[model samples]
Target: MTQTHTHTHTHESHPAIIKRLRRAGGHLNSTIDMVVQGRNCLDIAQQLQAVEKAIQQAKKALIQEHLDHCLEDLVGPLGAGQRKAMDEFREITRYL
Candidate 1:
């Protein structure tokens, strides 16, 4: 007897996402450095908040892309991968 196995792969915008995240990280690092250098506390706080918001926006964009492209294919009619993918999505949403 012979057995066969199948694998499915999903597309991801990893390079673009990495570039966005790196830019956000650079903003965060600069903000922290300003704070450490005795910059105005209020200004530092505002800059930090801006960096956080940017990071959140990038994360949301990546999640939306995944839902539109990857999840759509995985959860298509008659597919069996929806539950697992949705569970992962739920876990990810907990942090958002």
Candidate 2:
């Protein structure tokens, strides 16, 4: 069996993160309304794209804050496993 490691951090940007998610939720609702109203295809696509970007931005902000503040709590230099995890996180975030 493989052991799982967990790290905990006090999220200082929690409120800001919630605000961003709420904004994205609002954007999603607007997009839904546009679809229901039979809006133009181009307009609907643009709104969807906007919502996607907003969500990506929020994810980026949250990840950055985690790295900047939360990760700092680790004592001394990062070990191999930690470094690998960080690398994997960076790679996954490239889609944003």
Q: What is the per-residue lDDT of model 2 for residues 4-87, given as tens digits with 9 covering 90 to 100?
A: 669554577877778888888988999999999999989989988888877887788888776755665555567899878877
Per-residue C-alpha lDDT of model 1 across residues 10-90, encoded as one tens digit per residue = 346666777778888888999979978999989898888878877787787778777766666765753457667766775
TM-score each candidate: 0.62, 0.65
lDDT of 2 at 55: 84
lDDT leader: 2
lDDT, candidate 2, residue 85? 85
State the displacement of the C-alpha of residue 81, model 1, in Å, after optimal TM-score superposition.
20
| Cand. 1 TM to true fold | 0.62
Residue clash pairs of candidate 2:
none
The models' CA-based lDDT, in order, is 0.75, 0.80
* Candidate 1 root-mean-square deviation in Å: 8.4
